[model samples]
Target: MSYQRRLHPNLHMETDSQIKQPSGRWGQRTAYTKAPNITDILAELKLGHRVTPVFAHRSYTWELQKMLRARPRPVFDLCYLDGGHSWDVSALGVFLADRLIRPGGLLVLDDLDWSIATSPAFQEGPETLGQFSSDEQQAKPVRLLWEEVLPDLGYSHFAIHPNLGWAIARKRDTKAVVPAD
Candidate 1:
């Protein structure tokens, strides 16, 4: 988002400019690095008031649901899913994002091939061991969602970059099509 802002300094996030962070059960990850607060990072980037910071009191899913309920129509143009690589969280996040994003909107899912079992930061820790099963630890949840879930949902035009470990797909337009007779 900061990079996008750099390219288009006047860009506004509009209604969904709020930054949603994790909380509760989903927030119990062992931090391998001390990262700066997102709001501070955004502020440092001079993202300004256009970017509202809303920390999740529960989970990102809960906050997204609330946003969905408040809005009568799809508004966001893009949604980046990079947190909570587990199926329990990421899957539902994408589902809600489908409703939140407008037709033809971009949905970027990061760490497509990332698995807890292979993560250098988490592989040795109890977080990877006790929190996930052997299969879950080895499985790529983002990749599964990208291949199996998005196609069934209303997304197309995929661009999967394995080297970069990210996938981009556009939400399908829901307009009616006139078939040739």
Candidate 2:
């Protein structure tokens, strides 16, 4: 459900040597120096749980598209988009997640507040992109985006984490038919 750093052997070995432990399930380390790992999603799928992990960057997109295109339709029950932070990218991510999620499925957006909190660079007229921009000129747009624009979209559900940012969305209607394989 979330990305985590890979601990070095020295750190991991200290935990327990006696027991045969279950391996961790999340993706590869955040650096992306190595190949992408979706072991968590794979494990979930193996257990008959649906999963969809978005890879917004070019490198990840190439890999993700290949994997998704080969899978049966409506393969995901939920999606969490914590990838890129650009406005365009965020919007696209929401759109894509909307398409992939099953009706009544949840879609979580990490760092939505982060963009609003730090938005001096990308300006939108009189307002800043976030609530706390470095420049006064930028703060208005930031507040407007988070407080007004996002709400106007009628997402129907939202949770704001003081440290983590926002989780915004609405569940699609479950009455819609899922395509038969």
lDDT of 1 by residue, 143-164 (tens): 8999999999979856986655
Q: Which regions of candidate 1 are displaced past 4 Å?
A: 1-53, 71-74, 176-181
Per-candidate clash tally: 0, 10
Error of 1 at 24 (Å): 12
TM-score (C-alpha) between model 2 and the true structure = 0.47
- Estimate the TM-score of every prediction: 0.68, 0.47
TM-score of 1: 0.68
For each of the candidates, the C-alpha root-mean-square deviation to the true structure, in angstroms, is 6.8, 12.8
Highest TM-score scorer: 1
- Candidate 1 at residue 147, lDDT? 90
Model 1 residue 60 CA deviation in Å = 0.9
Error of 2 at 70 (Å): 3.4
Error of 1 at 35 (Å): 7.4
Model 1 Cα shift for residue 147 (angstroms): 0.4
